[model samples]
Target chain A: MIKGSLTLDPKIIRQDFPIFQQAVAKPLVYLDSAATSQRPSKVIDAEMEYYQKYNSNVHRGVYRISVEATEAYERAREKVARFINARSPKEIIFVRSTTEAINLISQTWGRTNIQTGDNVLLTEMEHHSNIVPWMMLCKEKGASLRYLEVDDDGFLSLDQLDSSLDNRSKLLAFTHASNVLGTINPAKEMIRRAHDKGALVVLDSAQTTPHMTTDVRDLDCDFMAFSGHKMLGPTGIGILYAREEILDRMEPFLYGGDMIKEVHKDSARWNDLPWKFEAGTPNIAGAIGLGAAIDYINGLGIDQIRAHERAITSRALDMVQSIPGITVYGPKDPDKRAGLISFNIKGVHAHDTASILDTHNVCIRAGHHCAQPLMEKLGVPATTRASFYVYNNNEDIDMLIHGIEAVKGVFKL
Target chain B: MSEDLYKEIILDYYKNPRNYGTLENPDMKAMDTNPLCGDELEMQIKLGESDKIADIRFNGKGCAISMASASILTEMVQGKKIEDARQFNKEELLGAMGTPNLGPVRIKCALLPLKVLKLAIYSHLGKVLEGDDRNL
Candidate 1:
């Protein structure tokens, strides 16, 4: 745990988010942070400040406002680099979302590197963003895609890792933390094993980066991707961190505008490291907002945030376990998981359960959660998930429990 | 009590769905799945004389709204002419549920059975129009 000076108080923290103040028919118990987090006032204000003060295109313009805009944008890149403890800002490539980032890697890097008969190893718990791109890549390259099976407890089978890896394994792409199960995989160990087999690793950190301290250098992953919206920032902006050497060798995923140094008819020279990957007019205000979100998280401290979420998840597991006919998925130990719980009421469908909860304004996700394969493995059509963040507290969990009881009552279970 | 969407009737139907099974040598069978919620329903109908639905059954899994709607739909359309069953729409389904409104995300669940019923009837019509009278 990376400790910081700041302490978290959910009451005070909730004030930073304006959504909490909006009056509704019922009090809001938002437990859908795993889907997308609610943004704070500071993050919102940062974007407004950029547009209201100096809203100009970055990189190419020579005007004073453009320079300021460019400086703010570059500063946001630096903040993201520092947030993830990347060795250099050059490693940070901003894209639309984690989906686009993974697609970029699969198209540019995987296309050039992976050959026919090569293996792309993924886990059973991957989100569609992580799974679909690889499937496309493997199909195009005539390479086979393999999956490391997840057990009934939602933990990936590390025992099978040795056999799953071979010289033919070109890449190993897996999620750092599952969005549905909340099981935190041992990414560092997996990366080490993949490195021994000469396979590049892509860590899908969409769920991990927001809730925990992420140091790319410490994890030693070659490439990683996460969405800004999942971390209290604006939509339409995400980060893809790659090693400097690997990025230099990979081709650009998109063409035109700022990504090129010079364009002459049929041929063009690409721009420098990070900008080589970022094409056209970038999400300037979104990046600045993400920087402000990073500052906000830093103020609260990642260690404190993790501790607070762990406390909430521990209480939630304890309370939810006591509910009759309610079976929670993922690891039973709170420490082995992130701050989410996907579960099912024995006799009630997940959608019906979600609908009943909505009557009380308790927001949760109910579906296959974009992991349909995993849903089949779990033998459930869908599961209702309640994920927590820094702003959540015990009262929210209590409200959730009450809402669930109401579901049982309404269904006469 | 306060405008509850899942009323007693809906829950009752969900718990004990009517005409829930697979039909043997059914005249027409069709399946549809709600991609968003992973709700799936398969409808089978046996056409009797005068193109009436002699027997109907549905088998699959879904939410209370979808399951209850399927049960109610199977019961409503049984013994009805195929053309009349084809005219069933969202208003009638919602009215049967005793709720005038379904939130946007859930409306698909409420209407999946209707979609399956329409597809099954259309398929049966196509088969009949094509003059494939072996089973008819």
Candidate 2:
């Protein structure tokens, strides 16, 4: 248990985030990092500094602050490329969020490659962001969508993935770590099998990249997406990492002021890679905050964070399941999962559980978690989820348990 | 808001919901889901010889507040005139539930039955349900 404890103390980490000091309830127990993370003071201050000191449009300004803004924005792209071990900064495209990043690919890459009768492969556990774009693309292109089944314990079978890929399979998009199940998929092996079938892979790293080390080159995925807001950065900024060869060949997703090199009344040439996809003025402050967030994560060390979350998740899983009639979802072994846990009480609805917990100022997420198809596969309408991050610790889990007991008392379970 | 919710009466209605079943050959029936929370409700009313709601039933899956609201709504309209059932508002239904100070989100859960009840009546009467921005 001592080894399982966080090497970087959560109490100490909580002090870095201003949100912890001020909440409707004292000592905020934020267990919803899977949905969105609270930013640290460094990230917040970085964004504020961008707005206050160097508030200028990127790339267009010949003046001092504009150059500074452009430098900061491009430097952020370089940091992201290094963070994911991408081949070049040119391969990293900044967009709104993971949702918009996926849509960008669906528009630029998917619209061109996917043909009628070509099917896209997805897993049963993908969030709606990954699923809906493909569905829309398939519907528009007269293609179909197939899913790899998740087992009772929330693990996807590589054998099923191998069998599911065939001549019609154009692309396989899946989450590296599931938001609901917290299952850390065998991403490298999955990508290899899909490549063996001559299929492109889009890895949704929205959940994984925030919690642990993720190398796009090592995974050998064709594309990857993650949001800044889920990793101690501000919202409205995300990264899309695509293979340089493919990205260089694909047309731009968005066309506007910043995405083109020269424009005429009817004719124009697009800008270089990375900038070609970024249309209009970008979220400069958000990207700068993301750079600061990367610095903060680097300071803490990703491996240490992963280990700490693993230890705490194991403890949380154990403590959560100890309650009578509690059915915890995802891999029981913390190694097979990430930092979150989804579960349900036998008779208590997920919303009721969340409400009772809310009374104690213990926040949790209920409802389908924007994974209704996954919810259907789990055979439950909704499941209460208590996710964790660097700031959360044992006391938060205790509060969660206290809230669960309250739920049992109120509902007479 | 949480302390005000899940009162004994609310829990009682949730545990043993009144008229909690499907009606056979109903004169009016409508079903809708709260897209926010995925709470679903179906309301059905049978017309009696007096052109009133002889029987009303609703059943679905959701949180305690949603289920309890359905239970309370069914009881409220079981023998009311069709016009009276259509006139049933959120205030009346929430009042029946002892007027728990629900927040904006949970208030939707509490009023979903009333919305579906109104829809069932309006659809039967060939009139569009409208006017309340609160969507009662």
Top candidate by TM-score: 2
CA deviation > 4 Å runs, candidate 2: A1-4, A23-25
TM-score for all models, in order of appearance? 0.96, 0.98
lDDT of candidate 1 over B72-100, digit per residue (tens)? 98988889998898776668878988866
lDDT of 1 by residue, A1-413 (tens): 22232246878998999999898777789999999999999999999999999999999889999999999999999999999999999999999999999999999999999999999999999999999999999999999999999998889977788789999999999999999999999999999999998999999999999999999999999999999999999999999999999999999999988999999988999999899999889999999999999999999999989988888898899999899999999999989899999999999999888888887889999999999989999999999999999988888899999988998888777
lDDT of 2 at A76: 91
The total number of steric clashes, by the backbone 3 Å criterion, in model 1 comes to 0
Q: Looking only at chain A, give the TM-score of model 2 against the true structure.
A: 0.98
Q: Per-residue lDDT of A1-413 in model 2, one digit per residue for the tens?
A: 45345767887888899988785645677788999999999999999999999899999889999999999999999989998899899999999999999999999899999999999999999999999999999999999999999999999999999899999899999999989999999999999999999999999999999889999988999999999999999999999999999998898998789999999999999998889999999999999999999999999999988988888898889888888999998899999999999999988889888888888888899989999999999888899998888888888888888889988998888
Task: State what share of the real interface contacts each candidate retains.
Answer: 0.63, 0.55
